[model samples]
Target: PKEDRERRGVTDGLLRLSVGIEDCDDLIADLRQAIERSARR
Candidate 1:
């Protein structure tokens, strides 16, 4: 597990989210948060 979870240094900022029956505003907020966090890296 450690070997498989090691960082590959590929900062693609890929966001995979599932908006299943949730509010659109909430989904956008989540994506915004993810992008903001990634940008801080």
Candidate 2:
């Protein structure tokens, strides 16, 4: 499965997100914060 996914251009850095009923600005801020936090690691 990993080989197939790689062949199809899917990799470890891929992020699949599903937005719920939250406000767009809230979601964006949350995502930005998460990315920034991860980057610090």
Candidate 3:
């Protein structure tokens, strides 16, 4: 399962987001917050 997941671009350093049916500004703000949160770690 791990090998198959990696072959399909599901790596540790990869962030894949599938957002749908959400407001544009809200998504942008959420992304900015996530980036800020991760940077603090």
Candidate 4:
């Protein structure tokens, strides 16, 4: 399965998040922070 996923372009750094019933602004802020943090790395 790991090989298959990698073959399909799903590598180890792929992020899969499930959004629940949370505030849109909060989600946006969290996502922005996460993206910024990852970009810095």
Off by over 4 Å in 1: 1-16
Which ten-residue region of model 4 has the weakest summed lDDT? 9-18
Q: Can you list the residue pairs that collide in candidate 4?
A: none
lDDT of 2 by residue, 1-41 (tens): 99999999898789989898999999999999999999999
Model 1, range 1-41, lDDT digits (tens) per residue? 54444465334554445569988898899889988998999
Shift in Å, residue 33, candidate 1: 0.4
Q: Using alpha carbons, what is the TM-score of model 2? A: 0.70
RMSD of each: 5.6, 1.4, 1.4, 2.3
In terms of lDDT, the poorest run of 10 residues in model 3 is: 8-17
Per-residue lDDT of candidate 3, residues 1-41 (tens digit): 87898999898788789999899999999999999999999
- The per-model lDDT (C-alpha) reads 0.72, 0.94, 0.93, 0.96
Order the candidate numbers by TM-score, best to worst: 2, 3, 4, 1
Which runs of model 4 end up more than 4 angstroms from their true locations?
3-13
Best-fitting candidate, scored by TM-score: 2
Off by over 4 Å in 3: 1-3
Clash number for each model? 0, 0, 0, 0
Among all candidates shown, the one with the greatest lDDT = 4
Query: For candidate 4, lDDT tens digit of each residue in 1-41?
Result: 99999999999999889999999999999999998999999
